[model samples]
Target: MTQYRNVILLALAQACFLATSMTMVTFAGLAGIAAAPDPKYATLPVTLSIVSTALTTAPMSIIMQRTSRRFGFRLGAAIGVLSALMMTYAVYSGSFILLCVGALMVGPFQSSAQYYRFAAAESVPADKSSRAISFVLIGGLVASFFVPTLWRFFGDLFEGVDYMGAFVFAAVVVACVFIPVAFLRPLEEAFDVGSDNAKEEDARPMGAIVRQPGFIVAVVNAALGYAMMSFVMTATPLAMEICRIGEASPEVIQQHVIAMFLPSLFTGFLIQRFGLFSILLVGHMAFAVAFMTALSGIEVMHFSVALIALGLGWNFCFVGGTTLLTRVHTQAEKGRVQGLNEFLVFSTTGVASFAAGLILNLYGWQTVNQAAFVMLVIASAITLVWGMAGQLRARRGRL
Candidate 1:
């Protein structure tokens, strides 16, 4: 297992694997496909796509246990290809509900893609895990660059043909994920399906493990950070669209997404230096900063920096929380506990994402930012309580 492990190839595969997330950028196409029959369902495509992934992630994990990571990823990518094709068919037929169903099928593929970072970590030593994870994240960052471009270019390509062009473009991105999943050299020490259950006895129930403060803190820290970021970032696009600050210039939105992913470049190293809790604290403060920066109004420059700061803050908290959560469980407990944690964490993000659009449309801007701040505060309070309780327990033990 002393392989040098070509980090570069691993990183590229992850980027390509993650590139499928850009399907959301194809919203215009989905919109056109749905607009004729059901205006209420116009946003359903992007929304349901996430819900689809959420529902399937755990089942996909089980399948991965029996299959090689390579094989599981291949299946996910293949489904992505199918989803893209289905999306094209939906567009051709102007089937709004079919587009949503296609989205549902797309979720498992994304669920499989979620493991790419873990694959990257397993490729290297413990010391390099953070770096490897960050390398994979680079893929996410790079997609932030092209997603909007794909959305816009494809939106323009078909013109009066409607968003079908964009749907077709998304299909191309889904197809791209297939090549990497196909050609990726499976990590040298990643789970071998045959040897996986060697320690099945060590598998603890989710309830018993999540009871640990470390586990609780890690999951909450993660869920809260994501929920808060989603709460705010979800609103920001609409908020800016309302203010007309950068709505006319689409580059502004593209730059905002770039800011979100760009900070990921340094998050792994930062976590290594400052410790996970420190990063968590910094993330809260950054969220606060992002919210405050937006209070002045949605100017392009103001929101641009705010969005980027928000994105970076999210990266630190999320990556830190993930790393810490990994530490709190044994192999036996890993599946159940990790599954539970992600379910809750992503559930929070989904609520926040959904609420962002709904709340912004209803209550206006100030209410949205204020709501995000409140969630951030609540999450931070939970973190502080966990840390303080741990310290008190340690002191009492000495007595």
Candidate 2:
């Protein structure tokens, strides 16, 4: 269908979005440190970006549902251009508060861009939904490859400001997505009933949807997976600097970003072959591995290995949880559920991001990893119980 072709275009657009996102993660904390009022709040900008994304999640979903996805995409990109420009001025003028505002504005752009995967799912058959979602995310591989390189290429574009060039280039990259969305046809909402014949009885209440076992597992895995990953990743650069591991900090982040998306290459196939439960279990295990490795030392190799594991874990949990969510919701419920899911996921991640610098400064690197380890264990335990309960129900049905 032509919608599939549109999906490809959206995927390209997703690549551009991820490129901007990765750059933010890579430099936002460091930038915050450069101009923050207090050194301890060095990650405040990054934390605010996440908090902003969380706040925008539901509103963006509502906008897409009421209008066209294309409209939301374009609106988001336009805002992105504004945000990037603000960031540019923020860095150039060395204004910390302005930088936070810019970061906060990025939330809407990210909130809209995140739906690319769901939009891809709408483009294909239900059976191929997971594959389509993965395909859209595969665009991140482009960002993974180019974001750090671009950061370096443009890091010194301004004579005195070190990172201002990066934001300038980021603005240009965000503008690139606008052109693709302009030429594309909007994908229709698949599950919602038309307003002409709308029936309140047909739509399930939010509480009912939230109570589903599958929904609980899906939200838990994705939210916690994201929170755990953000906790450690946000603090890595600062920790690297404290350890005097200068140039290698970006390299470590680059590797972590690459690892995060590389698995999207085959994750859909894994979901198909092994099933969501198995993949989720493995995802939790991957988080465990990352935490354990990080606790082992403060060496560059240790951080590198731990982040790689964290990346792999996030992919499996996030992708698997998202795909599983598709099975539970009807067309009408998509916007509501996805918005709530993203809000919870990003909000908790915001907390984790905010805590990262404080914990790293107050306690130590090992303590940060220790906290991540505890969260992972709880998430893993909950997932296991959910999976077992599902199996028991299946068995009872057979009997």
Candidate 3:
């Protein structure tokens, strides 16, 4: 129980972090619409937020390595609070540029929050790492429930100021992150082969580490899985609008968000029981089914089912990929490896999100789903080959 204290606190911190994010996602676009000079740039604030996250991910990871996770997280929480206040001021002043700047400032918080799962994994023994990762993600599930209520209670708290009070609420939520984080105990060092100096000496070059088949597969599943999820999820509302089911979009998206994090409740247990490769294969199949279902129809039922499948697929692949990554790096290499992994994952996600709108508008929803399907097939094939090669190597060793 004592050993698990950090995990519990981290989970609480994750919930607070995600609640702030969900609030921003819910209100940022509407605020942008009100403040922007041109209607076309209404989503620019959201885009800038993701861009800021991607740019800072690697640097934040390195910073945590030099300092400590507690320090880094507190710094991120401070940044989130400041950014939320800036956004509040932006709404009050109706300044589009200031809103964008505030959105950009929030990225470090997102980047830092992403490490909660990794930190959870670090809190537990290696065999239980998958469970720790999944448990931390349950925080997102909690946030999905918490955000709507928060809005209902405070949506109009500032009277004439529109979303100004909501942004203030976001700041308060982020500031609350300080409480649980302040209690987090320091994480133990990763297991290494020898003395600390020898461990440092044994660290492989980045190129050499990334060249490993395991590393490549981990990145493919995590990065491409995230990209596909973002691409499809982002396009869903727009696609529904075209299909004349736009009114149902919110319910469908709500269900999709629920599907995404609900499975974290048991995903780690499934991984522990059935193994990573099998779960990953199921994730690939889920994506395939999702794309096919979307292609088959545009009805509300079809959209709901497709998005649900998409979310489930993302959970499996993302969790599996993260677990796999932990097995590949040495203690000395943890910081750079995790940093590079995050950088690639979010970079692809940022590109996929930005492209989703363009591709859907230009080629239609069918084409967007088809492109994602094609990418998934390519990534799945690479993963399959890697898994089989790993089995063959084990067989040869036995012989």
How many clashes in each candidate?
2, 1, 0
| Model 1: per-residue Cα lDDT over 240-324, one tens digit each | 5567653333454555556656777777678788777778888888888888887766668777777767776787778778888
lDDT of 2 by residue, 1-399 (tens): 676786788888999898888778877888888888887888888898899888987778678878878888888889988999998899888899999999999888988898888777876778988778777877777666777777777875564786797798879999999876776654643233245444456779999999998998899889989999999999999888888885677778878988899998888789999889999999988998998998888899998999999999999999898888888877667757877887788888999999999999889898999999888888888889988988999999999
* Model 2, position 174: C-alpha lDDT score: 93
Candidate 2 vs. true structure, TM-score? 0.90
A best-first ranking of the candidates according to their lDDT comes to 2, 3, 1
Runs in model 2 deviating more than 4 A are: 1-5, 120-132, 186-199, 329-332, 393-399
- State the weakest 10-residue window (summed lDDT) of model 1: 25-34
Give the top-scoring candidate (lDDT).
2
**Candidate 3, 169-261: lDDT as tens digits:** 889999999998887776523222234544677789999999988898899999999999878877776677668876566566667778878
lDDT score of residue 70 within candidate 1: 73
- Of the pair 1 and 3, which is ahead by lDDT? 3
**What lDDT does model 2 reach?**
0.85
Query: What's the distance in Å from true for residue 382, model 3?
Result: 1.6
> Candidates 1 and 3: which is better by TM-score?
1
